[model samples]
Every structure is written in structure tokens, then in C-alpha cells.
Target: SRAEQSRAEQSRAEQSRAEQSRAEQSRAEQSRAEQYLSKTNAQCLKGIFAIAVLCHHMYQYSGLFRGKFGIILQALGYLSVGIFFFFTGYGLIVSYQEKKEFYIKNFLRKRVLPFYLFYLFLTAIYALWRIVLNIEYTRRQLIQSIIFKDALAANSWYLQVIIVFYIFFWITAKVVKDTKKLVRMIIICSMLYCVGCFMLDVTSTRYESFLCIALGTMWAVNKKRVDKLLDIKGLQLFLLSIILFGVFCSTYIIVDNLAIQIFSKMASALAFSSMAIIFVFKLSGRAEVLINNPVTQWLGKYSLEIYVIQGIFLLLRKGTKLYIQNPYVFIVVCVIGTLLLAIVIKSVYDWIVRKCRPQVVNM
Candidate 1:
């Protein structure tokens, strides 16, 4: 009996040591994520994707992508949003690093509050414009337009999906401490997205954006290994190959099956977005000036407002008689004008918030 008790104690001691080792490794990984993606890095990512999605939307409205070469251009919006989700996942880890427990109220308070304020302001304008134009509407539709993302537009569905993901990630982070299981969770979510596409005959970002966000979380969890991989010999060639491969795969759009099409689009988006973000990360210190330009800094700071403000500008363009036929000229002007107007809106919004709710605004 004494010998058996001694053996059991030895096994328990070994197990405890193993668990301690795992906890240490996790702490190191968390530290690495903070190092790899600082607040500044997050801002750079937002600025890049914001301008890109803005351009993609411009092309969509301008009817610029209408032929053999247009599919690649058409595919960029998906890629851009995928990258945006990547940062969103990383951002959650950084922003909530100090929290001892997952708090849904805190997430809603901090994550959704500012955006919801802006959303209420902008979408009300959209609704009123609809009302003035005598567009057929109902009380139900008005309520839906205010609350449901699908009621707003395809692009605007991002807000709904991202908010859902904020909650999802909070739950996941609280429950699953290991990175391996997190990867599996994302893959499962992707499979569910595919099933939803099959059943619904719809393939919106609503179904697919979670995959990218999961990829982002995986990256944050394994940033130490990722940095090491970047330093491997012949990485430049590897980078080039992935970029070309990603672009080539993105152009495959000749399918009748919606499920297959959605699958392909997800693959294409992941390939292209992963390549671009990894490449930018590879640049490290060299791209600082480009990323930190005064204009870029401003764009990053108010990127969300820029996104919301574009709709207002689009409405203004629709109402006015300024006809710019050339897509490039129109996009250039739209970008410049939107940036200027968004800056003004942000300034005024900040001033008002500081006067009334300083803690909420600056928080």
C-alpha cells in the first residue's frame, strides 16, 4: 500500500509540473502577441483596409468592373474585409489583456457603444432620405432598417457580424485556453458557414467573416512562431509564391453551385488577405513612414467614421447633379472629399463628446 501511494504521488507531481509548463508557455505567447501587434500596428491595419474597402465600394457603384478583367477587382472587397477581421481578433486580445474575467457588459460598453452612436446618427439620415423620396416603407421596415444589418446593405452587415464576433470571441477566450482548440473552433465555424450558404442559397459576409477573425486569433496566439517563420531562409521566394498563388486562386469564379462558389470565395479571400498582411508584417520597420503619415494617422484614427461618412457622401452624390463619368476621377474625388468631411465630423463629434461625456469618448 505504501509503494502504491508513493507511485500515485509521483504521477500527480509530474502532471502538476506539466500544467505549470503550459501556463508559462501561454504567458510567453501572450507577451509575444502584445509585442508583435501594438496599438500603432492595429491603427495601421485599419487605415489600409479602410481606404481599400472605400475604393472597392467606389468601383462597385461606378460600374467599373464589368468585363473579363473585372473579376479580380470585384474580389478585392472580400479580401479587404477578411484582413479587417484579422485585426479585429488581434485587437480583442490586446484591448482586453488586463481583464481577469470576461465581461459582456464591458464588451458592449467599450466595443459597441461608440460605433452604435455613429450608426444611429448615420442610418437615421438614410431612413429620412428614404422617407422624403416617398420610397415605399412600413413601420416594421423602418425598425428593421435601424436594427438589422441586412436591412441597411450588404457592406453594412459587417457591423452586425463583427458585434456578434466580439461576443463570440469573449466566450471562446474565457472557455478555451489552448490555441489548438481555437483553430478547430474557427474551422467548425467555417463549415457552418458553408452549410448556411447551402441551405439559405446566400453567401454574405455574415456567414464567412468569422473564419478570418479566427485566423487573426490564431496569429495572435502563435505570433512567436510566426515571427520565426518569417526569418527562415528563402522567405522572399516563399512570399512571392504565396502572393502569386493567392492572386491566381482568387480569379476562379466560373461555378453555378452557390455553395462551391462561396467556398472558393472564402479560400480566395484567405489567400490574398493572409499574403498581404504577412508581407506588411515582414516589412517591419521599413514601412513606418508610409504607415504613419499624417493623413494615414488621421485615417486610422477616424477610420470607422470614414466608413460611415462615405454613405452620406454617396447619398449626396446621388442627390446632386455632378456627373463624373470616369470611375478613376470619381473615386479620387470621392476619397478626397470623404476624408475631408470625415475629419470635420470627427473633430466636431470629439468636441461635443468631450464637453458632455469625456470619459465615454476618450475611453
Candidate 2:
């Protein structure tokens, strides 16, 4: 009787252990699924960061929100741009992978042409604004603005950078057949671009986050390995990202040499983007609801428009009656006004495209 009781106890212990193991396995599977950055998730993040970029410009140009908070927000602006670059690189690779030959053939028409047209439209608007304001300029200056050699609006540098990168991406795709070699070439090109910017004495903002584009390409090309690293429990991954971000920030602060400092800043931006994505992935319950909602998705849809148009308001608010004295009211008006204008501009751009080239509508 004693031996039978002991055997029964042993069997119960083994059953409990097996149940625990199964539960752990299930949790791991769930975590793996949650860790994925879906298209919607990426768009949501772009939406959030787009707003951050707006606030960054608001604080920088308007001189609102002074002190530590202002400093933090200004710093976030570059990080926001870096995230955008990351998405650009990631999205290009993903699309190319999916439609290899088709994407390669139509890269310029599908990608570069639309952006260039929209940019030209925006530029014309800016030029009109100058005429209305009686800000005199020569014919040569006007020609330069139209040709993208100069800009009529603030924060127009980004448009040029995006156009160049698109061309670079298309060329690289054409020349490089191997995926690993393609990614390597992209990284090298990005590094050279940064160095050129530095040598030319371009503002740090123009080049600091360029590397993140390459980082995105690397992530997509080696997604299997990257996902393996990301396969830990959600909480663990979140904490690890936090630690890495901290290290990156510290590295930035401690570095004094100019070249090293520039590289460190780039590294910091990459870490910042990584941390943001990880935080979104690990978020649960109510917090998750806030991000994954329609409002953010809509913002993401018009993110580029919002980004390009906000500078107009920024310029308007300075030395004009349109300016709001109170920071709170100004922010609200800018956000609402910018969103309305962005929607209208995008709709008009879409209509023009449909009217001009009905056949390319699906593209």
C-alpha cells in the first residue's frame, strides 16, 4: 500500500511538470506572433512619429516649450526621420522581394515619379506664397527652386534626400543580383553618402540618420536571424531594447571627436527606432488599443503630406497674424489645420494622377 501511494505521487508530479511545459510553449508561440511588425503596425508607428516630427519643428522654429522638455522633443525629431528612413528601406526591400522583376522594371515610374510630381506641386505653392508675401527673388532663384537645386519652403531638404535615395535604390537593385551583396552595397553607399554630407559641411540633420536606411535593409535581408533574436518573451525583449537605447545615448554623450560623434549619433537614432518598435510590439490591453486604432492609421496614410505641409504653417506663424501666442492653442490649431490641408492636397494629387494617366492607376 505504501509503495502504491508513493508511485501515485510520482505520477502526479510528472503530470504537473508536463502541463507547465505546454503552457510555456504556448506563451512562446504567442510572443513570437506578437513580435511581428506588420504593415499596419509600421504605418501606425509612422503616424505617431510624423506627429512627433511636427512637434519637433514647432518647438524648434516657434521657440515654444522651452527647457528640458523642448530639448527632448527637438532631439526626437531626428529620431522620427530616422524611423521614416528605416521604413523606406524596409518597404523597398519587401516590395522588391515580392515582385522582383516587375518592381525592378517599374521602380522609377512607380516610386520616384509620383513623389517628384507631388514635390513640384508643393514647391509651386511655396513659390506662390513668396509672391503673395512680396518676398522678392530673382529669376535665377525661382529657376533653382523649380529645379530642386534650392527650396522655397522650410524643411525641404528631406525631399531631395528621399529622391536621391530612391534613385540609388533602383540602381543598386539593377546591378546587384545577390541579396547579401545588395544589402552590403547599400550599407556602403549610405556610409559614403554620410561622409560626403559631412565633408560638404551639410547640417548634421541631413545625414545623421542615413545609416538607419541601410539598417532597415539589413533587417529585412536577414529577417530570419533578426527574428530569432526577437523571439524572446515580450517583457525581456522590451527591457533589452531599453538597455540598448541607454547604451546608445551614453555613447553619443561621451564621444567628443567629430567623426566619432556623428557615427554615435547615427547609432543612437537606430537604437531609438528599435526601442520604439519594440515598445509598440510589447504593449498590451488599453495601450495597444490607442496605437492600433483608425485615427493613427489615417495619420500614417497622410504622413508625408502632413510632413511636407507643416513647414508652410510654421513659416506662416512667424511674424504674421496667423500666429497664435499661446503654445497650447497654436499646437491645436496647427495640428487641425495641417491635417485638413494635408487631406485636401493628397486628394487633389490623387485626382490629378487619375485624370492624367488612367492606365497607371493600379500602379
Question: Candidate 1's error at 29, in angstroms?
Answer: 20
Worst 10 residues of 1 by lDDT: 352-361
RMSD per model, one decimal: 11.9, 4.6
lDDT of 2 by residue, 1-363 (tens): 999999999999999999999999878765645545678878888888889999897787666779978768878888899999998888888888888878888778767877778778888787777666556567787678667777776567788788889998889889887777888999998999899989998889889988889988887888766666665664676677678767866777687788777777788788877777667655633367567789889998888778888876676556443545776777777788888898998896776555444264465
**TM-score versus the correct structure, for each prediction:** 0.74, 0.84
Give lDDT tens digits, candidate 1, residues 1-363: 999999999999999999999999867654543343567766766787788778767766777768865665666677777878778776665444445354433555556655555555555666776555444457776678567624552245677667666666657756765556755675577567657756886646565444677667677666667767765632674577486645546444556665566666666666666676666555555555565567666678877667666764454335434456666777777788878877877875565444443254464
**CA lDDT of each prediction against the hidden true structure:** 0.64, 0.78
Global lDDT for candidate 2? 0.78
Which sections of candidate 1 miss by over 4 Å?
1-36, 65-69, 102-105, 131-137, 173-187, 233-251, 254-256, 316-333, 344-363
Best by lDDT: 2
Error of 2 at 64 (Å): 2.1
